[model samples]
Target: MIVRPRPNWFRMLLVVRGSVLPAILPQLLITLAFALLVTLLHGRVFVWKVSLTFVPFSLIGLTLAIFLGFRNNTSYARYWEARVLWGEVLNDTRSLARQALTLVDGPAPSRIFVHQLIAFVHALRHQLRGTDPAADLDTWLSDEARQRLQGARYKPSAILLMAGEWLRERRRQGELAAPLVQAMEVHMGHLSDALGGCERIAGTPIPFTYAVIIHRTVYLYCLLLPFGLVDSIGSMTPLIVTFIAYTFFALEALSSEIEEPFGTEPNDLPLDAMCEGIQATLLELLGERDLPAAPKPVNYVLS
Candidate 1:
């Protein structure tokens, strides 16, 4: 995700680091070339003159813009929901770590529980992004615990189960009160809810047919725009068509990138930084001052 301060308007116009321009550049060039050809040929293919009025283009453009706006809004809603779910995970994990340290009697069990929570955070991040959790798990888990996780299909859920067992053991040893156990369980349940929400968003996407229809319409409209404007706009058809195409193409590209908020794209959520932040903050709660440095955005983008 982009993390830099907003640039001035003049610089904003030329900024490319976080914009969709790079993604849609090829489409823009194709549209420009096609528009120039149409203008030169006077909207003709061989002997057949392709006559089209701006009226149909105008009506279609308005409707298309509305549909695009709706789709983009839907995509942004998904993006925002994913962010909220991650926020819940962060908050719940912090609460769980606090409970483990303050409510539990022994330092050994408390540290183990905190480490398990950190492992769960890292595992959840890897699960969402479809990356291997081995390195992250190794950092937080003992060799035996990591071996146990090797057979578990869902590493995050497995870590959560480990955490629950840890709490149960503490309770059995008379180290934690029944009420405190229940309180920590509530936070654990919230963590489970957050995990489930993230999975749901990652598994289900906007319907394929809806995306296909909008994608086809946007491209068709952009490609055929020159024919409608060439007769009236004369030599300015390419410039005008290119500008219009840029808007549609950029919006479509941006929506696609953010729709899957777990992705590593510049516009997607910064899951890497988020997971690290959760780890550092939790460790800080346990009196550890030698924490990992916070992630910095590379070229104005955090991932």
Candidate 2:
């Protein structure tokens, strides 16, 4: 989700202040210390000459790089696809709100029902993040509806089903004609599809064995890199290998962090904030005096 160009080295040092650093720092120091030890122990015996690569190191490094790249790329694609699907949800929610304002008669319970629909959006958002849904619902929902969702699992889907039932009932009564009810139900169906799409992404993940293999290979590369370079590169082996190792491991960690953007990480996708957009879009149609502000972005990132 980070849209900025890859930072230069100076900025990168600052930007890596998150999870990647902790994983990299230890490997770097270990490489450095061992590099120094080799220089002290073999400084006199080996010439100043240095050889950069052993055939196997190059092969192994390339293999790891290609495989890791493939994994990360696939993961990012899945993450971005999820984002696009959620964007559709936002657009469809707006469409639903527009349809509600135009089709439903403006009267007694109309304002209340429409506002409750907005509450359902917020409720769905909080539910997805495993956050408490009880408080966000009260302002938009009837006491009974709020109670139904408060302790329940699948909060968003529950509210959605309620909305569907409301439409069905209106159709049964003389209030809303069958055609209008069907049109509204179509939007409701989109809501259901969005929920299903999100659930699929959340449930499915890259195989654990694949992730484990990638991790183990990265560590092994870092560990064995010194042996390949120490004899020829001498004192420089540690620093050089560590630098190279840092690049490999850092990319690996970053990709894994963003692999499931819905996850609760500083770098994860901003579902809560997207849900806020839904609220603003719906509430504005109701022409309420006061509307809640949209969810604010963090330092630079949204959600």
Candidate 3:
């Protein structure tokens, strides 16, 4: 994700790091070249003159823009929902950490609970991004705990189960009150809800056929635009078509990037930074001053 101050308008026009320009550059170039060719040939295919008026394009463009706007809104909703789920995870984990520290009796058990909570956060992040959790798990989990998670399909759930058992054991030992344990359990359930929400978003996506139709329509419209404009606009057809194509192409590219918000793309949620922030905040609650360094944006992009 982009994590920089907004640039001036002039600079914004040339900004590339977090924009969709790179993804749609090839399509834009193709549109530009095709428009130029059509203009030069006077919208002709050999001896056949391809005559088209701007009327159909005007109507189609209006409808196409509406569809694109709808799709973009749907994609942004997914992106925003994913971010909200992560925010819930952060808040719930912090609450759990506080409960373990203040309510639990022993330092040793509380430390174990806090470490497991940290592990759970990193595990969920890795799970969402489809990355290995071995390194992150090893950092906060015991050898026995790591072994238990070795072949576990869902590492975050495994860590949550471990945390639950930790709480149960503490309760059995008369270390934690029944009421406080129930309170912590509520936070744990919130964590589970967040995990499930993230999973649903990651597993289900906008229908491929829907995306395909919009993608095909955008490209076809851009390619056919020159034929419609060449007769009327004459020499300006290439510039006009290419400018219009850029908008459609860029929007499609951006929507595709954000639809899967858990990805490592520049526009995707900064899961790494988010997980680290959760770890830091929880560790700080445990009286640790020296924490892991926060992730910094590289070249104005965070991942």
Local error of candidate 2 at residue 276 (angstroms): 1.7
Cα shift from native, residue 45, model 2 (Å): 15
Across 1-303, the per-residue lDDT of candidate 2 in tens digits comes to 333456789888688534477766876787667666655655333655333356789999899999989998988887887888778777777776777667766544456656666776776667566677777787778888876776677877888877777767666766778888788778788878878887777778888899999999998787667767777676787788778888888788878887777876767887777777777767777776487776665555566
lDDT string, candidate 1, 1-303, tens digits: 999999899999999888999899999999999999999999999999999989999999999999989999999999999999999998999998888888888777799889999999999999999999999899999888998998788999999998999989999999999999999999999999999999999999999899999899999999999999999989999999999999999888888888999999999999999999999999999899998799999999899
TM-score of each: 0.98, 0.85, 0.98
Name model 3 segments beyond 4 Å from true.
Answer: none
Clashes of each: 0, 0, 0
Regions of candidate 2 where Cα sits further than 4 Å from its true position: 1-14, 17-19, 38-53
Cα lDDT computed for each candidate against the true fold = 0.93, 0.73, 0.93
Residues 56-121, model 3: lDDT tens digits: 999999999999999999999999999999999999999999889888886778988999998998
Cα error of candidate 2 at position 159, Å: 0.7
What are the clashing pairs of model 3? none
User: What range of 10 consecutive residues in model 2 has the weakest lDDT sum?
Assistant: 43-52
TM-score for candidate 1: 0.98
* Model 2, residue 288: C-alpha shift (Å): 3.0
TM-score, candidate number 3: 0.98
